[model samples]
Target: MTVTASIDIASSPEAVRAKFLDFASLPKYHKGFFASLTPLGPVEPENKIRVVFSSGQKMYAPIEHNTPTSFAWTGSIPLLFTGGTKFTQEEVFSGALSFLMGENAVARKFGFPEKTKKGWEGYNNDLKAWCEAK
Candidate 1:
């Protein structure tokens, strides 16, 4: 299943980039999903980071990119699914920001695609509010 969500923020891409890269603050803005984010090492492309969900599930994904306008990570839940997710920031008219989130996943025979899509919607809405506040 693939899902995507996006929103426009009132901030510049540079400001959004800085906030996006601050892995430690993820839980603060993304209240429900992330319980904590811990860096495994230095922040760089391909470095691993641990994401502990509020549900207590842990996932480790490698940084696919750390550029000013884009970032991504690829990870999997063993025996269930595997996927990659990315965030992109683009400058729009009047200095507004467009933030997009996309995910592509290949799931096993048992998977809940509908539920995932709904969750993405909520996440994106929350992200929009967070970025716009900055």
Candidate 2:
């Protein structure tokens, strides 16, 4: 299963993508969702970065795609899950256990999909605001 969210921003894709990649500059306008980024090591053509969220969760994802209009990284558990936490470039989440991240009892108890979706929504809005302001 996979979850995705999209938002249309009144800015060029290049401008938006630039801000998204600028993780350190994000907190100023993106609220506190993105805290900081620590370089783990050289990852060949692209390096992996550790993104620390305001919620205190740290995600170490490798840059998989970086172009003028889109950006992506793979933070996965081998065969289990992968998440990038885009716009219509839509941030994605997928895994074998992803089905459990629905409206089921346990999912509701833990706010799996809801909280995750909300986080993406907030992220999209923040990105939009920042890009438009630029």
- Residue-level lDDT of model 1, residues 1-134, one tens digit each, is 23444445566665556665576777667877556667788866779878786668888878665554555565522111112223322212121211122232433222434444454455556655676783
**Residue pairs in candidate 2 whose N, alpha carbon or C atoms collide under 3 angstroms:** none
Show model 1 residue runs off by greater than 4 Å.
Answer: 76-111
**Best candidate per lDDT, number?**
2
State model 2's lDDT: 0.61
- Name the runs in model 2 displaced over 4 angstroms: 38-46, 76-86, 89-100
Measured by TM-score, how close is model 1 to the native structure?
0.63
lDDT of each: 0.52, 0.61
Candidate 2 to truth, TM = 0.74
Best by TM-score: 2
